[model samples]
Target: MRAHHLAAAVLVAALWGFNFVAIDVGLDSLPPLLFVALRFVLAALPVAVLAPVYGPPAPWRYIAAIGLSMGFLQFGVLFVGMDVGVPGGLASLVLQTQAFFTAIFGFLVFGERPRPRQIAGMAVAFTGIALLGLDLESIAATALGLTLVVAAAAGWAVSNLLMKAARPRNTLHLMCWISLIAPVPLLALSAAVDGPAAMATALRGVTLETLGILVYVALFTTLVGFGIWAYLLRVYTAATVAPFSLLVPVFGMSFSALLLDEPFTALKLAAAVLVIVGLALNIGLVPGRIVPQRSART
Candidate 1:
């Protein structure tokens, strides 16, 4: 990768890394599912209006699958989990488990085999995750938060595979359209679960901070970060681009501790290291490169 693109990759990681805290802040004012619904709405509206869909319209079923799984369900659960207690730092680490799940899904669905190293990495990472599950710190680290985030991670893996299977000619465009599609169902879900009163309170309570977070997430993290990432993928091999993503958890942990005052426990540290190592081994596999087709999740 060119130095410029490498720098852009790092920037994307940072934007996404700190985004967990943004979710936490926004959820203070917004209900979880409602927050997610608004997020996708804000993310998609301008793009939907300004940009044409990435390719010919995708299959409705495929579009719905991506919209619901990736945009609504994954984020819906994630915001709820984080708001309940999942520390932003640890949440970032746990979500990276998507790397393992993605490989698993690819194997099961596409018959694509994970390299032996990746298998080993998955085992190591899961072992660390098990340690995390034994967490005595708080509910955030416990099943309440952990399970939901893990579910989100698994959803993300499925979303990526759907993209692969659909094989859209222009994935970036499909992503924009999926963003548009994902939010509506979530709005309906939020109205049912969060209740009309909760939604009313959230809207009434919206402050500058909440709006800032919403805009930051919609524009910076989802749009700008991904725009640069997609550009890098088009220009470079995945191997050249993917490992820099390991830095996301680093920034996430730092921002969580510094910004949110979350703990940096021994077990969490160990888990982070193990997960990073596992992801490194899995991502930077044989042949020293992955073709651009296997894009990293933003």
Candidate 2:
């Protein structure tokens, strides 16, 4: 990766890390569903308005799947999970399980085998989760939160697979479609689950702090951050892009401590380390000797 791309990766990581804090703050003023709806709505506008400049318009099918799967289900359930009392730090950690699930999904659905190092990584990851599971307070709070977040993660993984399977030429075009189509479901769901009163309630006493959080999440995290990511992925191999994502959890933990006043528990620290190690292993950090097969005698 070039220095600028490296900087972009770190920038994306930091912005995404701070997203947990933003989500926590935003939930204070708005229902999760409503907040999520508003978020994608903001995200969609620029791409929709500048469609000609960005790329060709997306088909409805592509738009809807990316929208519902990636935009709505992913962020919607995540917001709900976090709002329901998932600790920001733990929520950040748990969400990384998406990579594990994605690997599993790839193997099961697409018949790709996990590399040997990946198998070892899974073992390390299991140990990390075991450490987390032993924590009483974190476990209790995280049970429901983790469930919902995991659901979102699965949705995200599915979306990723679909994006690859579809192989759209333009990343921005796909994202535009996702952004455009996502808000409708989010709005409908938010209205159904949270009701009109939730919107009214959130709007009535919203402070500058809350609005700042919303703007930050909408612009920085969803729009600018993802835009850069898609650009990098377009420019490089997915493997190159994927490895930097491990930095996300590192940033997440540090930002959580700064923003949410979350503690750096030994368990959390250990879990973070294991998660990073597992990601590295999964992506083949260890060198393997290349063995050549001998030619068969006739």
Candidate 3:
């Protein structure tokens, strides 16, 4: 990869990392489900406005599947997990488990076998999760928040498989169309789960800070970040693009500590190291003879 492209990849990672903080702040004002709904509503706007210029990137079914899994399930669970108490930094690290989940789902759904190193990587990463679970500092970093974040990772894994299957030429276009499919269902779910009164109350209470958070997540984090990511993926090999994502958790932890005043406990630091090492191994970043027959895109 060229220097500028590498910079672009890192920039995306930074944006996505800081996104957790944005979501954390947004959750203070809006219920998780409702916040997700509004984010998607704004995210889908480009698709609606640009319909005449750039139509759907794939079949509606594929777009819908990606939408439900990626936009709805993943963010829905993630925001709820963070809202419940999981710190933004921890959520970022935990979400990296999606790589392992993607490998598992790929094996089951598409008969893609994970190499020995990949299997070993999963074990190491799960050990980090176990360590994370043992931290009894509060409920936020323990069972409930951890489990929900892990579940969101699974949803993200499912979306990865769906996107791989779809094989759209333009990832940004596909994403925009996927955004279009999420809002209505998410709104319905928000109403059912959070109740209409809560939604109304939250909407009535939206401040400029809340609006800025929404714009950041919807425009910068979702759209601009992914737009650059898609460009990088096109220019470089997935291997090159994939490792930069590892920087996300590093940035997440740092930004959370600085911006949100979240502590970096000893256990959290240890877990972060283990998870990042596992991810490196999983992606073949750790040099070794054991190589997979095929590279799995997380």
Candidate 4:
């Protein structure tokens, strides 16, 4: 990787690391599913309109699948998990499980197997997560929250595999599709659980802070951040682009403390170390030969 790509990778990690803060802020004024719906709707609209100019359009089905898997399932589960009290820092750590799930799914769905080193890395990471889970202070206090986030992580893994399988020619088109497809299920679910009234309240009382936050998520995080990252991946090897992503949780923890006032407990610190080590092992696997096609963009 060139120094420039490496720097861009770091920037990507930083933006995503603090994503938990954005998520928490957005959730303050929006129902989890509704928030997700709004997010995708906002993200999809511009990209869809500009697809012809910037890139080729993907088949409608591919776009729909991206939205369903990445937009709806992934964010829906994540928001609910956070709503249920998953700490942003811990949630950041746990969500990396999508990598493990991606490996598992690739093997099952596409007949790809992890190399020995990859498997070993996964085991070590899993052990660390187990230790985190056993921590009497954090995981024990928020079992339900942890469960929801883990489910979210698993959903992300499934989505990653599906995206890799589809392999849309235009990566931006793929993201656009996720944006387009995500709103349907999210809207339906939001209406069902929170009722129309809750959504109405969310919209009617939408403040500047709410709108600003939404725009930030829709533009910078989903559009610009993901767009740049995707372009870089195409320009470089996955190994070159992927390794830096391990920094997201580190940023997540720091931002959680700075913004959300979430504690950096001893247990969480240990879990963070374990998670990073696991991510290193996972990404450091023989890159070119055992390319992991399945990876979550966010």
- Summarize candidate 1's per-residue lDDT along 235-276 as a digit string, tens digits: 666777788788998998889899988888888888888998
lDDT (tens digit, per residue) of candidate 4 on 1-298 = 5577668878888888777888887787888899888888888877657766765356677667767887766889998888877777677888998898889888998899898777887888787777776864654337777778878888999888777777777776677667877888889999999999989998998889988888877777777788779878877778767777788888888888898888778887887787778888888845456544433542
Summed backbone clashes in each candidate are: 2, 0, 0, 0
Give per-residue CA lDDT, model 2, range 71-122, as digits (tens): 6668888889888867766777778777777788899889989888888887
Cα error, residue 59 of model 4, in Å, equals 2.6
> 36-55 in candidate 3: lDDT tens per residue?
98898888888876689877
| Residue 288 in candidate 4, Cα distance off native in Å | 18
lDDT against the true structure, each candidate: 0.81, 0.76, 0.87, 0.79
Question: What's each prediction's TM-score?
Answer: 0.91, 0.88, 0.94, 0.90
User: Which candidate order results from sorting by lDDT in descending order?
Assistant: 3, 1, 4, 2
Candidates 2 and 3 compared by TM-score, better number? 3
Between prediction 1 and prediction 3, which has the larger lDDT?
3
Q: What residue pairs clash in candidate 2, if any at all? A: none
Best by the TM-score measure: 3
Pull out the clashing pairs in model 1: 54-173, 85-140
As a whole number from 0 to 100, the lDDT of residue 159 in candidate 1 is 90
Native-to-model Cα distance after best TM-score fit, residue 234 in candidate 3, in Å: 0.8
Worst 10 residues of 1 by lDDT: 289-298
Error of 3 at 270 (Å): 0.6
